[model samples]
Target: MTLVNTMEYNKDDLLDKVQEDAENLFRSGTYFCSEAVLQTINELLGKPYDENIVKLASGFPIGMGKAQCLCGAVSGGQMGLGIVYGRVEGEPMKDKMFDVSKKLHDYIIDEYKSTCCRVITRKWQGDDFKSPERKEHCITITGMVARWVANELIEDNKIQVGR
Candidate 1:
């Protein structure tokens, strides 16, 4: 049996599936941006981790409950990283977790030009919570983050690429 890694699978197809799943979740309107991203990752991983983790991500949407802080998608991606690499005891994996988090954060910033929800949603939502544009913007962010996080997980061997 071969263990999967970055070079062992079709990375693009995996990313595409992540993106598609996230978009479907977004359109379902059953989850917030952050919840959607994290939930999708959980689903793709066959729920190896506690499925209840999805509830933990509920408060992250709309910039941490509309406080306009960190982008929910970014937060969700970091949370997904934690699901795979987070240490439950000792401090051995601490550095790895932080490193992966920073990488995910950088990826978000590079793609979205910012990691703040207020900034990214400014044009789409401004001060209007019910703006229709917010959904599309959040959906795009959710898909992008899901794909990036999945790639990171696969490359790090936290998730088997072909599984």
Candidate 2:
């Protein structure tokens, strides 16, 4: 698996499906951070859940409705992990879920020092929420979080890139 550490990922359909695709959705102004993450992963997984699944991620945007605690992208990515690694109620817990979930959190913390939405976007708090700079910053993180999750799925052999 070509992990993201190499900064090398296939520029194939997987890129379109995960990172760039989600970025576009967020840039379109309809989908927010968490929604874009869930939407892109849903598409990549062949829509295991229906369109309404996106609502699960809606509350996470702007750090749980602008509470600015957790990073919405990270929260959304965790939901993506749940979709992949979570088991049925009667089944045993998947061991990999905790590990992967923490890894996702680590990814954000390692890069930005904290996964809190306020911390990550601290520089842009004074700007208008719809300002291009603010939007671009969130958009970039949205793409990065999606790409990181996609890379994890690929490395763990959970999902194929193109599929």
Candidate 3:
């Protein structure tokens, strides 16, 4: 129900808007960046994967459960890529899945200069983890990650784009 330049948005636009909203809502809770992205992407993809899969992303936040390793956003984006192109047991789509994952990881690293949550957080909001500013920073990043996945879906013709 958003309007840009006084023009009503289509279904695709609405989907994007809701995903962004969901990201913020989820982040306000104990959910981390990876969980936020996974949940949002699941809904945006029309729930292609089971909602229960969000649990799989739980341990990825704060760099694999506060380990300060890989960025949770990057991990979630890779999961999203897998959700779209991954194969079930005995399937053979690893190469394709890896390719899309690499694209997402490269994009995030290139844009943010690293794939660690600590580095990303420091670069964006310093070391304050409890301030409203920090919350906003994470929310913005979550939205950006969701949008990037949506764009990739559109580019691959996996989803329709709004005109």
Candidate 4:
């Protein structure tokens, strides 16, 4: 559904709704890790998940595969936060973006209990050789991270919460 139509909120209620929507997005997907995150951001922000955001975030999974640092899902969550609260030139509200991003990151880390990619992927990591389990794990983790970030943003009053 379009966020504008689906969203109903006063200033106090937006975050909870956004977090709920984010969790719903994650649970609904079997795959679509990156796309689902982008979609969640759009829904939470009451914007559209257009091609540009997708293209910019396309490199996330590749980065995860190469860097082997944080999980791609977590990266996707960070990217979504950046997209919604990112700083821009001449924007008087730029400082808020950093605080918001930090809060989101901290919340995800706390919720997941670990930020290490290997740790997060440990459950699905195996020598199966071409098993789809790894991808599924990544997708699930992505959803979790998305939910946490959405929750933080909402709770922190960084975004408009919806009913």
Clashes of each: 0, 0, 0, 5
**75 Cα displacement, candidate 2 (Å):** 0.8
Question: Which 10 residues in a row give candidate 1 its minimum summed lDDT?
Answer: 1-10
Decoy 4 TM-score against native = 0.66
For the record, the alpha-carbon RMSD of candidate 3 to the native fold, in angstroms, is: 4.5
Q: What is the lDDT of residue 54 in candidate 4?
A: 56
Off by over 4 Å in 4: 1-32, 90-93, 128-136, 156-163
Per-residue alpha-carbon lDDT of candidate 3 for residues 25-48, written as tens digits (9 for 90 to 100): 556684677887777777666787
- Candidates by TM-score, descending order: 2, 1, 3, 4
Tell me which residue pairs clash in candidate 1: none
Name the top TM-score candidate.
2
For candidate 4, the per-residue lDDT at 34 reads 55
lDDT of each: 0.79, 0.82, 0.72, 0.59
What TM-score, over all chains together, does every model reach? 0.86, 0.88, 0.80, 0.66
Best-first order by lDDT: 2, 1, 3, 4
Please say which candidate is ahead in TM-score: 2 or 4: 2
- Model 1, total clashes: 0
Residues 59-161, candidate 1: write the lDDT tens digits: 9998999898898888888888787778777657778888989988888788878899888887865546576667777888899999988887777776665
**Residue 34 shift from truth in candidate 3, angstroms:** 0.9
lDDT of 3 at 75: 83
Query: Which pairs in model 4 have colliding backbones?
Result: 8-163, 14-161, 14-162, 15-154, 15-161
Global lDDT of model 4: 0.59
Task: Kindly list the per-residue Cα lDDT of model 2 for residues 1-163, writing each as its tens digit.
Answer: 1122222335355654478888988999768999988888776766789888989999998899989889888988999888999898899998899999999999899999999998999998866466798889999999999988877887887765432
Off by over 4 Å in 1: 1-9, 125-127
